[model samples]
Target: MSNYSYPKLFLFCIGGTGSRVLKALTFLMAAGVDIKASQIIPIIIDPDRANGDVTRTIEILNKYRDVRSKLEFDRNKFFNAEFQTLNSLDVATGEGKEVGSTTAEGFRFGIDGTKEGRFKDFIAFDKLQGANRALLSALFTEENLDAELKAGFKGNPHMGSVVLNRFSESEDFNFFASRFSQNDRVFIVSSIFGGTGAAGFPLLVKNIRSPRTSLRNPEWIKNARLGAITVKPYFGVKQVDDSKINSGTFISKTKAALEYYHSNITGNNSLNALYYLGDTLTLDYNYNEGEMGQKNMAHLIEFLGAMAVIDFMGLEDHSLVTEDSKAINPIYKEYGLNGDVKTVTVKNLGRQTRNRVFKPLTQYTYSYLYWSRNLSSFPSNQPWTKGFDDSFLTSQFFDDDLRQFNRRYEEWLNEMGLNERGLKLFRLDMGHGLLHQVIEGIKHRKKGLFAKERWSFSEFEGYLNSVDGKVRATALPALFMELFYMATEKIFDDRIPNSN
Candidate 1:
């Protein structure tokens, strides 16, 4: 209904873990979860160009953009926040120097000269002679030297730290600095056990906290309210022969990263808020060093990590005090549930988490189910149609963009519901008793003892017919979204108990 009025939030997602967390964040936004930031600028920093997880997330983001661009953010707040890329913004560094054009497409940030070749080649190992060569050999194993750069660091944080140290000099960081205003905030998502995330998190923070003179708006860049979520080991991978990645090393790697962070990040108050999330009941996924085979399922930890982003943005500015580019009172946070169960429901979540997510998710679930079930059956002659025909329903807006978004949304829920420590929020397999048994533990409240206990698809259509005129969109796609948003909101308020 209205445009963004709040400040932008630059979200820096690093590595495979980062990509998964961002995917969770995107689904949460689609479900109309309240994120205080008006615009989210996702800067994905991953070297594995062919990573399936990253590829899938990028596809979802592009589809989200296409779908949300067609509809207004009405009362239901579905896809209300705006997202932008670094190149899309108007940016210039110090002395009117423009940031160089990037080679990375979409939301990714390309590291320099990493497109092809070996790790030894990237560092110019052949050029070294005598002690220099010997020192390099001492530092890196033969396998490390031969590791493919494109396949990622393969759990080698040492390699990642060296490779990612140049992040400050990247064009993407410069563009981000130029576009940043004083009120804008930054949040980083990474993992402590892996290569890219473990190394990139500290290096990225160092660059932001101590900006170079070449960067535009250096003071604002240095003093901005910063937050981050560092995911610990929550999943493992199957043992593969001759693979550089090893699940047995995760705990040791995490411990090392935590020590380094304590000295350089938390000890010096580098961030305003730091959120930590992990689980011991890990799921074993098929191992691929990187590339297309690296896709992993959605986990409860990633979902909670996304919630950390929302919580960070919602904090009061005064709580995050900074003096000369250093936080005065940095906050550390961890997530917990009301009960530790194998299958999670809305009621099992902590009160704050439940209050923030349950209602919005339920409303969107209702909208999705209703539209998926009844969209084709609506009479073309209804007043709500405005004389539109079946062609409008079959247009690209509905047939392509909306359809793809719906499919992905449904898959995300299913993935989380089937993963270890599953978040079983809804019973998606049901065909009947939708209003009464769709949600895992919550249900619609009946009007009276004698009245119908649950509403059928016919009753849902009747409610739609009653409210279609109230939606104020002229375009068919916008009208369609508005109708569902309004109907779901009303249905949630009138029928769903304990929704407040």
Candidate 2:
């Protein structure tokens, strides 16, 4: 029996990632991944996805019924595909009911973002004068949100309650028995660059193959995903990175996401795998005129990733972009100006870089008392050099600048008393095992690195030997082992803050 469930694979291309994701989907078809007109599910979850341009784009394509569909077909004849409706933010009662407001209105962008929470809590706090937990309560459980969306259902109509419900509700995603056989490799193409990537990816994976499942094969969730990230370089499209700012507020949340999947699964670690692919000099893109290239490139990567699912069990990891850095500007850097990029750039490069770049500057940075007095001073969360580790970076690229950053990050962690477990949450970064699995698996399958653009087996025969003895891979175990020590030291020093 074939491992495929219905012989079709579903690649949910959510949010800002839709363009590239669709491109990757098409690539799979050309490579002979059995895809059909009715099998693939094209899901768009970005707030931007619902905007006029996107709607118009899809409409034009659908209306013509001839300019060729965006996505691709699979290698298996049984695999089929279809375009799904893009989800929208429920504005009516989703927010208005929970937060009794002066102006009862809702827009998908959600009030320009900062005081983010559920409608219930937004109401309780604004209209009801509720407590912090009460506000937090308005958020939905993670599991509910995951289940509703993954089931191919658009979320709650109003307030986009499912998104809110995800945060408050502790319930999470659960992975279970294979409605398919063990051989079917599951591939998810995602951007580790934005909100969905930061919040949704982990939840999706957890639900699919959660550590806690009821199935007989405790291994059901094991090694299923084989992580793949579409890392995009700094396009310089926007001056401030509001999306990244939003993500910044969720640092620990991001850490938790990484922790759930990044672990030491040595042999045949199945589901818990991931890789990255990036395009750096997007600098060539003109903000106003480069729309064509951006859209085209997006489709390309997405299709390639989808093809990887049908053809093999690996990912394309790269260094041009960062899963940690959204490759965008920081919004927090925008408050002082008239929102002019030129002016902002001057002020930031000359004055703000020191305080803003590396913050949590002083012990009193967060003092509400002092904060009230110095309302003009910008206080940022301390800089955490996430994803890039010390031992590994030193061994690989050996960049002195990076080593310095990692050193600073380690000091911060030491101060925070981040234990081994807390540290382990970060170990799933770009390293040997991740790259090895993808490369080795591809070799075993006799597939070209780029479907035919070179990269043969013999060329990669000694690829592993080229690096400084897999420095990054060696670092994982070390971090796991030493994490406990730092955690214990914090316990001894009693500096560990209560993680509420």
Candidate 3:
């Protein structure tokens, strides 16, 4: 799985929920989750250029790429999956033919004409003369016409559908099509009840399946192993008088979208696999109409939605077959927990989810705890610190990239735990029980008649010392990270019973 000879995956993340779920997927990749793709090209599609979720996700992705670039995918699985932006693949063509001239910062797929003024201005409402103007007015309300699109569609999918219709003609999308190769898969993440997502999902899929588009590799893209996750209303926004976004209309919008999808999306075999995820234990987040303030707390549903991506990648090619542009066996899936609870833990996750996530996440958490709390104050005599001097901590990889990345990791954990239907996977308040009680509901194995000795940071340190002598990497940063990775895996397996 660590080999680079595998197929590439083009992941299209569509809206605010799409950005948040992509963020969750990055966390999983950082933890070294077994994603089958050799390289992942994440194409974030959102018209809201300043969306807080998109900005934060793009930062995390760049940081992850920076950290991964410094390390080889040898023994360490952390950041093993390679990530690249669409613009970064412009050099892949051998004929000196360029992709396009879009000044995207290499992550976002910028749609043309979306950064401008109001909806009325975009549609040229003033130029329309008699019946055309009346028809437009009848279709759109006064508020919808006046709504500023610089932020987004403002919870109006109608506007988004119109604005995003020309997405296929954009340079970013053409670049994606040109770079697509054989066996490359595509996974789209979006929400079913929002503006950009609800409108973008069907349109994007339609363009991919359309033969009339002027994109490269139309045949390969049309029959590609495409999968999508349409996130339902898992969260709600607080009611504000001035805000156009209303949680009250979420379910109604979802129902309408579902009806359209049933007839056009699944009914026509537009996708090979479709995943649906929603949460009844809704959290009321602060209301913001698709701006920088639109950032919402991380939720368990997003994590599970990310799992849907991994599951799709892991599927056998035969399981997802297409004949005559129609699915022979279209797979529709939904997530289920072991129990219904407000606070979710590893124990609450289903067997497959637990088996996939429990150990990697725990090991990564332990690595974070040790490095953040004790790395700077390490004893000089320690075997792991022998070759590495004090200057090692000040290296850019350590001082800048890794430190900033770890801070984001901690923030992600806090946000997930603080959200409604919290995922309390790790006890962030480490002072209470430290390593032994860190992972919720997982107890450490004890030795001796008194059963007093438990797994501690000291024990973890010892494992690190032992593994330090065995691990090898090209750089000290990779060596350091891999040493902790190996030590955490070994210590967790030895000390935590039923860890397998």
Candidate 4:
């Protein structure tokens, strides 16, 4: 590969699932997983203003931005990717004032008269002609036409289709198009079984690839390297008394969606690459159409979906687009394990997938666990954590920000482990001897007595001290992360399985 700068990746996260999976991708990127992009811009689209999952994801993204801004970036490979929002991009480029509110307020085109009225009133059904009213009545039921238009579409794709079709005319869309360059790429994430995602995915892609006379770089945006991952239903929900969502309808909805994609999306070559992932082994969550009740456990499928984004970024530009600026025999991918196992481990993953994720993930998780469990025991004289009052380890740098982020990261992994098709990569409950327990069956590897004795706090401190001269001396966050990377790589090299 040449030594040229990488292009920016524009990620359009379409709904609740999209937001959650973006959160997972953020954590993986922070841990030094290689994604072939210079920067990433995440745009979340969801009409549910009070969605718990989207809210939490925005909070984490903000915190990540704050922490990354304070670190040095000379030769850093981790936490070096730039993240931007449409509003921020507008300000940075001096295009205009902020186009929209923050991600927490949700992304939706303004409906002029729908805040305190029924959908029928907002659409002016009474003013339509006789034949038009009859046609509208044939397409939508009374409940669908008269439902309130404030909260969301209520798991109804038909309603979402009508509401979200106006997205291209919005100010945010204009700002995004203005900043898009010919070298940049776009990837979208959505769920085929939900309301906003099912409807928004195709609509957004259509607008991107459509010819627009108003936009500045319509042709560039149209022919940009495009990829998408449409998640099938992997989990169900228990039935509730008056719930608008029914888990029983997931399969039927997915079938309908696949048929639509076969006709309009895949056959027409709308996307350059597509990925599909779902599981037969699913866990039933509580029924929630939107809002606070919709917070879900992290799943293995979302992590794999995020991996699909990385895989897409790694593809060559020629592999995605032809000389004529059309999709060139677009690639389709699906994720799978090497063996049938209820509890997935590093050994169970395919060789290529394991090689990409296992070592980085393990190193990050182990370093976090070690610090959380045994930080007080490290000597105060060490170069990495020295100084009585000015040490980064003792200051709020670690206690306030890094510590809390590490706990959330551990919780995310633990939630995935407890869910269906469990990803049991680490033992989070143990305090003593936790480093050796990072991977299952790691302790049984044949090693000398000195190797076994090396899994101690003193050994970790010594490893950190030994790397002081090798790495560039920088800020506390950079030094701390470098130490963890060196320590974990050295300690786990012999015991961890070699890539096939």
Candidate 5:
């Protein structure tokens, strides 16, 4: 009615980093995307089920009102909306506290026949009132889904179902109907590696894509979706200092999601999903699984940049293309579908770093697809990684600090699901003279290099040249480029090698 169409945003998260990520993204949306204060809706997905330091971190973010206030667009106008937490039964409480049966502010999905399903990890949604269920269906009905799927949903109030696909049709339809009308985008911020996020995401995607067909009808689901964000897990494998709890499953899930996006969201469908990765230098004390750093701030800036693009693109007058085809502003369109972008940097850092290993390497990753013999790295595609830690980065109390950034990026990914393939790291092992001589026979070409002040691709002859009494052969820059790109989209397989 306002003579404008708004792209709705949504977010889902897993643990400590998840909540923080939501808050950071909200800040970006309010600032970068410039959504009106009254128009934005924020949802946080907490792992109210996990046990670990990571869990504790998530709890803190869940309850941290002070932190939420810091992300405000305007102190006077913004509604200090808080996160709602989810439970093992797939129930949610408005304030993000684990909803117990006794609380009035809590809400649950109606699970009728989930017990009979084949899914071992079947979702058990909390029950809702019959009247509320009917009210939902009557309110948000659309003709897109087949009548059979819609008729399959059961609005029964007492069933414990996790998979909405297990619920009756009307209630399921009504839930997302309310959501879509109220909001356009949904963010599911969680570790692709974790039980909750992995299981929850595919289900969430299904409902939004097919609104009335969800299995369970919850009390407070509001609308269908225009888009989704998928945050991939970024961390080190379990080392003496860092544990592999989240990273282990997160890596594989992230990979699977990347594959999913690449396969489905072909061509113009890619406008929906986006990825963001955290860095590797974890913490000492609390670095059990989660870590944060200056890289997060950089990542935040990246998403903020993305929000800017989305916002600018969404504006009708900004482009000459018809509303139906182009995505207003997309990296793919900027460089042409196969543009092969080098890098996009956020200036005004007012900062500097002592050592940047992945610069040239990361830069090389962006300009071309990556190749590695390691299967784990998902080589043979462009490889990328996230980070260029800001002035705020530090090694002391590193876990907690890095935790902040993890949450921020996590929130961004939750709102924008992974709809395509992207590599996050790229590297070229320019071995010593002997190894280099042998490598030359394979015809390894140099694409580019990330140096101080700019990202450039120069011709290299498989050898380092010390121009100013300094060995300029560094891999950090390249790694950075690869990591960041990984968070954005798929790597070129021709460059990425089959893994080790």
Candidate 6:
């Protein structure tokens, strides 16, 4: 048995950006980014059942879980991490069978009466007393209250707070609390400007830190290691007819949310650690409040937000909160870059950030490119591909599941590259010779005819040949990942100059 015992990390992804960032984190984890936790449970909270971003993220998480389960845990660095839905964990613990049919279906918790109900009906405006009715009227416009609740709160936290308050009584919440162990930790990801995120973050934290008496293991849940990333406004949407969302209101909404957080969140020491991140260079997305049209391009800030989760998991126990009864300072963090360049490269990132991500991302990108482009043409005598027959290569496991995942991974990186403060890690346009295109900012100085053939399959094969002894015990995913890591590092030294 492996010496390493796995711990669980429960993640609450609150809204649209929350889902997108979680998707980015999933990709990074697949690339062997160290999250430090053994298992991750992602819980997505959004009213829009047909939300494009949320749906895509849930699909990715399901695929990740399926792939990881097939590759048995062997202390390998690649695909070593495990992902479980809250329902799976509950079922494992003998709490109950899952309510939803699939893992993606299990990811969401629907808000009662939101689908076809109006906000006024949701809050029972006619049933409230005069002062309460007046308060509600003052807080929400008729347009806001009369608006359909199925889509979302439309960037209004007033409606979200009322609707999301019911989450504590949810069956999923009970299951989550039942499975909560003393060693488990919780992390939240949300955008401060949007409705579901803005209202959900604080409420969710509050409940976790002060779980109700009815919840299983409430005491343990209260003391769990908690961390959160509150994303500020990082993108704008184009104005469209009858749209309630506006780019201009992002700052104001963020400011309002920050003020509330200061008093209720930071002032009260509600969280053990808090991470803040936003980009001044925001991307302009097509305007859509909800549904399939609301899909936004991946942004650099979302990547940074994902990084914060990894960083938080690495923090020493009690570093963010005091072990004793006395109050301790909460850890506060903000993302920064070394340069002000619009097109961000490796050098633009902080040394620590670059060091953590660069090598693994590069290696994974190389591995993916090789599999997609060169694997078929490479010599069959290669040890790694020796046992692989045409039927095996064409199997649904590889041709469908793994192939689709690789394509999504490439698309994820491409979208990030195209977004503002772009992470130009790979040249997205190239179809072949992808390793040379790995480092976008660096200049390659060719040494000779062989140098012109740098990053070729033969060179990659030669590097694999050199590492025969190191990979003697490694199998499939790890063997493949280890080979790519070794090959990429060698090529970096031989071909790319000034690379750190």
Candidate 3 lDDT score relative to the true structure: 0.84
lDDT over C-alpha atoms for residue 48 of model 1 = 83
Of the pair 1 and 4, which is ahead by TM-score?
A: 1
RMSD to the true structure for each prediction, in A, is 2.0, 25.0, 2.0, 3.4, 17.9, 3.6
C-alpha RMSD between model 3 and the true structure: 2.0
Q: Rank the candidates by lDDT, best first.
A: 3, 1, 6, 4, 5, 2
**Which residue segments of model 2 deviate by more than 4 Å?**
1-6, 27-39, 47-185, 211-227, 230-234, 240-272, 284-307, 310-500
- Model 1, poorest ten-residue lDDT window? 91-100
Q: What tens-digit string does per-residue lDDT give for candidate 3 at 229-330?
A: 999999888998786888899999999999999999999988999999998898899888877898888899999988999999888889877665577788
lDDT scores of the candidates, listed in order: 0.84, 0.29, 0.84, 0.74, 0.31, 0.76
TM-score quality measure for candidate 4:
0.90
Report the C-alpha displacement of residue 132, candidate 1, in angstroms. 1.7
**Candidate 4 ranges with C-alpha deviation above 4 Å:** 1-4, 74-76, 90-118, 126-129, 146-150, 322-325, 381-383, 387-396, 443-454
lDDT of 5 at 192: 45
Scored by Cα lDDT, where does model 1 land?
0.84
**Residue 213 lDDT (model 6):** 72
Give TM-scores for every candidate, taking all chains together and pairing residue i with residue i. Answer: 0.96, 0.35, 0.96, 0.90, 0.38, 0.89
Judge candidate 1 at residue 478 and give its lDDT. 78
Q: Show the lowest summed lDDT stretch of 10 residues, model 5.
A: 348-357
Off by over 4 Å in 1: 1-3, 92-101, 381-388
Write one digit per residue (lDDT tens) for candidate 6, span 206-302: 8887777776676667777889999999888888887798889999999999999999888878788999998888887888888777678887888
Query: Candidate 1 lDDT, tens digit per residue, 1-500?
Result: 23455668999999999999999999888888888886898999888889888999999898888988888765447877677776676653345345656554679987886778898998899999999999999999999898888888879888988888878887777778888877889999999999999989999999999999788788888899999999999998889797678899999999989999999999999999999999888888887888998888888888899999999988998998777889989999998877878878888888888888887888788778876776675575555556467786678887788788889889889988988878888877777455657788875787656666577665666667778779887777778878777777777777778752
lDDT of 4 at 1: 32
Model 6: what TM-score? 0.89
